[model samples]
Target: MSQTDVAQANPATRDAEVLIVGGGLSGALLAAQLLRLPGRRRILVVESRSELGRGEAYSTVELGHTLNGNAARMSVDPDNPDDLTHWLTQHIAAGGWPESDRQHLPVSQLFAPRGLFGVYVQQRLAEAREQGRARGSSVTHVQGEAVDLEIDRDGARLSLADGRQLRGAVAVLATGMFPAARTPQTRSSGLNAAALDPWDVAAMAALDPQARVLIIGSGLTMVDAVVSLEQAGHRGPIEVFSRHGLLPHVRRQPPAWEDFLAADLSIRRPRQLLRALRQQCHAAQAQGIDWQAPLDTVRVHIGRLWSQATDVQRRQFVRHVRPWWESHHHRSPPLSAELVARLHGQGRLRIHAGSYQGLEPSEDGGLAIRLRYRGSQESVRLAGDALINSSGIEYDWRRVARPFPRQLLARGLVTPGPLALGISAAADGAVYDARGQASARLFALGPPLRGMWWESTAVTDVALQAKALAARLAALPL
Candidate 1:
């Protein structure tokens, strides 16, 4: 059913029928699904990291770093809502992750550490691999970065950073989100070079215990940075600069509110939806219920609402409501949020409403930065012994300074997505090429489809996309 090209470099071993450009959560989930089906085709996954499931999000070793959502909501199996919960239950029963008892929360609502979650994902992939092995199907991990790709009538040829090449009938771009602090940018902001990685607790530990630390952005990432600082025993002042100066709300398992979006079809515009949501929250709060109850209902409808909005409406939403929406929807975990709240209340973590201009010359032998406060035109200067650019992920592929994205854009292999949030792709994750043609051999999912699906980075979002994309690839004649 699948046509795979033979690798001339090694005639004895046939090339993969499907080549995944990344081996992160999205790639691993997709591979697991593809392997589960009754097929004898070979699959190849190329990743720069030594591990497959621990992408940028899960690679952190800190136990303080937890998933944004709880186990019930973070399932890799789309068909089974309690897949993660069940796995976590068995995992705990086996005396694994004894740290999970701190909160005394149930397994369903317990927030698993990102490192442990990576283990769960890897175990799932391992099970799929064993199942595939018995069926004569095989999946191989190519430990290299894919720098370039060429697609022709015959198949796809991928060139890696180590001068190795792989050919396959179909190739999927599962490259996950590139964090702003780590990824190289087209226009170098000396910030990344000077700032400490938000997840790097070891580097943070090396700093002075009382060193004033400067931070950028006040979203979930900023919360993580604060957690890292606490773990590193750094107790100095933290200055956070963002345009809105807003922090993410804590994620909660609130009572289920009525699905108002599904019941009412007339509320299509962004403004209309906002008004209705406010009423729902207000109503819920009036009844002594959690305000998050109503907001939770909107998660399932975001895809339809985002995809159907006009370009003008989309722009309006981005300019007017995006900040608020992000802070509310993409919330922080309870423990992390509590730490942030405590720090903020103690005046140690001060949030300044402003736009970061750039680095300024330091006169006191420390890193200096300047930013214009929200309502003022004049710039304010601040200096600290250490800095962290927790400005979030870099989704725009064009601005990424990596060799692969640069080569893809230069060769006209793909185009920028809507609002420049990721690569352009069709409804079913088929990548749109330079001329707006959906390539049959190329597919994408997860964060790469951020522009396509407004809420594409969550675990549930990636799992759903992985399942659908796997089914499509299996049914494809190519």
Candidate 2:
């Protein structure tokens, strides 16, 4: 099809060489890199949210919502590992901030506020746009939700909720995590007041300060909710319910001479790697350093270890060990952890280790949570003024409620991975269809590609993927 014909076919399409969905970190970074390429191809970015950089992760209004990971290790630029630190220094210097306030620390030591990081990302995008404008290259940013994706003989087409469409030679899906799937019983009961997703800030805000709140899971999301509640001046008692009543560990300061996992450790099998990691952790602890040091080393080598694992080993890891791994690997900010501890110490927070049977409406117009404790023949019921599901994103691809994945599955444009955690994609993030044919013009990134690359969700891993994908896209002929 001709360029004019393509542009005329869709309202938002203007014959761009590349189109990116989801203007979060990955999409925004990709757009910036594409602008650096020596080409005149138009680039279009569609974001469902009004904000370009915040997405779901950094869009919180609470100032207490800090990044779990440190800033030194969270740079958008892969070439310079210290780019985020450099940016922080430059920003502080330009603003005449005190040097005492800004210290050179380990990337894992700095828990910057999530909104500040969002601002940094937005600044980078603004610079890219300015550069593109100066070079006379077309760049467009559209604010809309992409509800449908159609891949025809000519190119890719995206249909928005507003009845507008965008066509491009290539499209990248970086839509990030979908909302958590609600329990069947909860949905059937028709109670919309319960917050099934942590992103429902309005629902969380609507609760009275004196009302009791029950959080579904005890992970990072739960920490975020607790921190947000405290920041909002909530004075009510809070309860966190999970299988083990396990909360995320607090981030620790790194030791000066900590070295556990060697740089040359071979990780070809999942079990072997786990054993080695445990051994390294033990050794580090024995040396008077925290086990987190060794775990950090392992994180840097996770992609290689995951790539080496057999399908059975991968499934085993997910089934038997993924939860434990996540609790340790994804730690909470020290401040958040301290707050949780303080709440517990003061009898304001209660953590229960039990299986959530279901929820029932109480006579008092609250929620009666029925749960079964371990080794108990009898079930118990607890009442809460509000319920918040902080269970994290529902990972089962079959249960996803979004239109793009469902439509893609119906059209045979995508298939679930062997373990079905996410869509099947090649090593380079090129998505494969149900027919087992890889699409040359389509790719998947971020959490959706978790099935293929087990370590793709974290900021460090996604940032590296963004840089590599940018170079790959730049090399592609328009």
Candidate 3:
């Protein structure tokens, strides 16, 4: 198609050549991908937040909240694994992130604050914007929440919360992960309504120094909640509850190991992969090496292994191996892990394996919760001064009470992803409608494709998907 045909001149009919529904990391990276490509089209990104790159994950201003991965592995550039490290090097040298001195590690191994990472993402996007401008392409940020979207033979029409509408040749849904602590649910236990936000240190600060705190879920989020409480000066007893009561293993820098998955293609089934991985870990331990060395090699093969697995195999993994996989894979940062270890040693933090039943009526102005301890049928009542819902991400769109997610499901624009993790989509990111048909106009990236790619939420996965989707959209007949 000609350059003129790529961009429509009518402001009413075509506000942009492409419309991105979310302006978080996923959306921002996708925009960068499209901008760098040779094109002459207008792109508009709609986000509710004032800032563009920081979504729920990176929007936190707390110095204690940091990315789980180090700078080397968290690059937004798929072609360059060291991109974040390079940026962080100059960032530290320029007197930014003064805390870097405490780690005593090279910039490549440093764990960066989420706020600083957001700045890096924004700067990269700005550079891409300049590149796009030189190629007669432009990107505009529309500050508003996208509530509804409709696809047509020509393109897509998007509606914002403030009653504004925009038309584009294609629309992309990059709405990031919805943390259970904050996102509304259709049917909830009312825990979120009464609980303090997991990332909200200010709310935690209001509590008495010795107030007892109850926490639900013991994943990386729970680790963050502990860090938040500590930073807020809360020295009270903390009770953490979950079905498994498993804590994330602390992250460590390990040496490179063999890419076992690449060398052995027959290890496709979950059991087979697990057995092989176990053998590798045993071998590494025998050699006085960290087990994480071998585990990191499997990161590149997850999408292929997940997508190609049978439904039965996938179920087996989720039911039997999922909790262990999560605890081992999604590791806690060292600094936060140190605090948790110290507190646990001091008897200030306790972990219980139980299932939360519901809330109870409390007369002492404290939060009361009922729980059935593991292996017991009878429920028990537990009370605390505060509660936090660190239950993790709600990937099922039907359950999410957000207007946009609800609208998309109600309108049949998208379907629940594999195993109901995120919305379903083809390997190339063309979203599948409720009818299981791949869409040409609608696309999704990041956490929305969790069901499609089991490890889709990581920065590397999103970066690769953004680049591939941008190329697919660029080739369209729009």
Cα RMSD (angstroms) for every candidate in the order listed: 2.5, 4.0, 2.2
Give the worst 10-residue stretch by lDDT in candidate 1: 1-10
Top candidate by lDDT: 3
Task: Count steric clashes of candidate 1.
Answer: 0
Per-residue lDDT of 1-478 in model 2, one digit per residue for the tens? 2334333334343367778888887788778777766667688888978878777787765557888877776787777777777776777668722332443554335677787788888887788777877776656788998888887645688888899898887788887765452422223323324553454555567779888988878889899888877766679999888887888888776654333345446556877778877887788889887888777767666777777778989889988888788889888888889999999999999998877777766787777788788668788998888777777765456666566667777888778875787788887777898889777667778878877777777776777787777777666655
Clashing pairs in 1: none
CA lDDT of each candidate?
0.90, 0.74, 0.91
Candidate 1 TM-score over all chains jointly: 0.96
Ranking by lDDT: 3, 1, 2
**Worst lDDT 10-window in candidate 3:** 1-10
lDDT of 1 by residue, 1-478 (tens): 1233222223233387899999999999999999998767688999989998888988888889999999999999999989999999999999999999996899999999999999999999999999999998888999998999988766778999989988887889999989999999898769898899998999999999989999998898899999999999999899998999999999988988999999999888888899999999999999999989999999998989999888888889989898999999889999999999999999999998999999988877889898899999899888889999989999999889999989888888789989988989999898898999888878899998888878899989999999999889888653
Candidate 2 Cα outliers beyond 4 Å, as residue runs: 1-14, 94-108, 134-136, 179-193, 196-206, 256-265
Residue 458, candidate 1: how far off, in angstroms?
0.5
Residue 455 lDDT in candidate 2 = 72
lDDT for each residue of candidate 3 in 1-478, tens digit (9 for 90 to 100): 2234434434457888889989999999999999999978799999989989999999988878888899999999999999999999998889998988787788888888888999999999999999999999999999999999987655688999999999998899999999999999999989899999999999999999899999999998999899999999999999999999899999999999999899989998888999999999999999999999999999999999999999889888998899899999999988988988999999999999999998999998887999999999999999899999999998888889999999999899998987888999888888888888887778899999999889989999999999999998898656
Clashing pairs in 2: 72-107
